[model samples]
Target: MTSYLIKSILCSGILIVVYHLFLEREKMLWFNRFYLLSALVFSLVVPLISFEIKPENVLKPVITAVPQIMEEMQKTGVINSMIATAESNSPPDTMQLLLFVFDGICLLLLIRFLVNVSSVLRLKSRCRNVKIASAKLILVPENIVTYTFLNNIFIPEKTFENAQVRDEILAHELAHARQMHSLDVIFIELIHVFLWVNPFLFWYKKAIRLNHEFLADEAVLKEYTNVKSYQLLLLDTVLQGRQMALTSSFNYSITKKRLAMMTKIKNLNRQYIKQGAIAVLAFVLTLTFSEKIYAQIEFKSKEVAATFPEISIVRFEAVADKPAKKPDQKGKSGPGISKAEIDEFYKTIERNTTYVKNKKGRTDPMVRMEPKMEDRMYELFSQMDTDQLQMAADSGIMVFQMPIPVKKAPTPEMFENWKKPEIFGIWINEKHVPNSELNKYKYSDIAEYSLSKLYGGALKGRIYKYQLDILTNEEFDRTYDRRANDRVIITRVGWVGENRPKSFAGRRI
Candidate 1:
């Protein structure tokens, strides 16, 4: 999920960079319009496409080695995976809380979108409709600028009184209605509702809005030959209007680009050159963001088999690989684990502790297994010959881990000590701050924390013995600010093999 978001953002960024560098300056308004919409839609789509390459094409040097010792450990029963332990209570999952926050914000934006649409609908139903020359104008009571929504051109009662400006404004808005620019606004707004955090969407919106103004200006100039008068009128117009996300406003502060594009001469050669460059960029981005899969290949060498038989077995097994599921936390009952038996085993070890001299030259308790445990251990190894036993001893003692019930994830309540006044210095997300900084956050916002004793450190001329560090859930942090990080990170990580889920967003996009 993280990878998909990153790839989509990166692809959008690359396309945006090319547009700004090569296409924006050229006199190719039509091509620019097509490219802007196509690039945005392509950015959203290219990350979901992938190409598979057969393993025969992949280099063998870097991919041949496989870890086979893990398989041996599994066969020897040394990797006990079924050990069960008692379950304990835990804090609220931060990820779930972040998800809830995201959905809540999306709902609010959706409602706001609907409200804007309804307000337009209400105006369409109640306002006086006056048809002038080929345009439908909705005369509203408010002192706002002329704007277009769907098929209706909304005109302010104050702005409509002027005879000369009215014709020009209506002509501009008619172009918008004819070109269906409102649909573009609606589509981008819907995207903004969900992916508002994506900075590229904001850029895309600006580009889309600016392009609409250019198109409208081109249409108005075709009818009215006075480009200077139109530019002056645009400059003279005030930017006081009710900003609607779904409507294209006539008084947008994009007069400079609109005026420049009106006088600029169209060069066919330059347009073709820019289009070819954009095509190359699109192709490069497709390959860069795409997921590449390779077919399974088994390399067998007689020399490698004579040197390491285990690695050869692993290579063969790699030809038919499947996804490995993570071990379940709430394990079922299995061998070598029972509450009563574990308690008895610990009691035996405690009884057999003996005093011995340590490296510090002080006598400390050394724990040893009781004779009964020693007899059981010997019985397990009785079948091995002397050579096998010597080899085992040379490999050193192996400790088999048993699952113990404990709190693994940090809880918000655990930071209560640091929250107390003047008790410990607080640091949230690696920034030093006062203890009061924690007041705004809840348990579900924190991902993890650490406490450490400060030996001889003073902060703000006050001596502190301990300090607390906190790392909040990133999803929670991102909700507060959408433009926090401007840098885009592109990664080539993806899932492979037949076990990959069939109903994933990346696969469907």
Candidate 2:
């Protein structure tokens, strides 16, 4: 909302400057009227236009290593202390307050607008109707200047009674009525009520009213012979009486400019040049005030793997023509962890594990550390290549050990319990299967299975917290174990063993 308002103000300000500089002094009255009205409408709409910019450069997909957590512990005593500092103590919203103040002022302005309309209607009802020059004239008894409101022309009783006053005053008000200038006045005033804070609105109101006066003065000059005498009449009505907000009054502070414009000679060539300039400005502003969007392309298959070798884990062939950036190139390279930093991380882990076991007496194997494990861990880091090392640095791994739980040979009852509806989801042989299909696989047929927690607790409107995956012995040896032929290697901060050994699965000592 704030961005839209700022853009609108900027666009209107620039267009108004162009009007004052090039078009204001010209005798192209109708063109000036069109420019002012269209400028306001265009300012509010141009910011919504958008253009999408598609770049030729392609971006490589980055892969991250993840470690699964088996269990977690927290202190329940801090719950009350945390709840006491919730959002209730936060500060009030500034935008809501501003909207409230804006609405209040707009409401007041609307009431004042209604009161002005009511005053005009009341004067219309009390005046004695006098038909003059094929239009009904309302001879107002109050001491107010001659003004036009919608189709009604209000003339002061004295001005109507005076024999000396000519029909130029009547002619001016009738032009306003014929051209329906009251609609423009109402439109701008209502806009002013809502956007009262914008400084450009004041300038807009002044320009629009001045343009209306110019049009009316031209209309009067077409019917009358002498332009000087009409200028004198405008001068005499300078301080005639008060004017209503919703009406086009005869008297304006810019009387001198009106008189000068009447005698100013029209240049047809200059008018055409100004119109062409306005067309160019509109085109430029449409481009300037619009939004720009960038397009992204996605790559799939083995082609991606050969092109983006630095991506670490490539699943597709190399088919892209553009070569990937070299690791030594001076662009955005991945973070590198120093030897000292790795040693600090090891010390922090050792300290925390020792504290948990000694102080809390926790016997969970996941939290326990094996003896002389740091030597094997440091050796794993030393063998990694540039991409592997950079990926490890970016993962921000906190713990150094990850353990996979092993279960005994499964029974029919155990297999039945796994199929319960209480579980979040189940996958058999890496394919999601229904519950009825689970009856076909016996307990002895199962080779390996794992239960893992889902970080996104709920997905696609289902309450999912944990996922269970099972692999039949046939599927395990034939596909699962040999799946590494594609060489999708992942780097993690932990002990390693091949095929997940009984104690530490991938631990290479």
Give one digit per residue, the lDDT tens place, for model 1 in 103-137.
89889989999999999989888988888655578
How much lDDT does each candidate structure score? 0.57, 0.60
Estimate the overall C-alpha local distance difference test score of candidate 2: 0.60
Stretches of model 2 off by over 4 angstroms after superposition: 55-92, 131-135, 161-165, 296-509
Per-residue alpha-carbon lDDT of candidate 2 for residues 358-476, written as tens digits (9 for 90 to 100): 12232211223333344344345544446545444443222122222223345554566556433435667756555567778777887665444333212222233334567677775
The Cα RMSD in angstroms, rounded to one decimal, for candidate 1 relative to the true structure is 21.4
Off by over 4 Å in 1: 55-92, 132-135, 158-165, 298-509
Alpha-carbon deviation at 212 in model 2, angstroms: 1.0
Provide the lDDT at 22 for model 1: 79
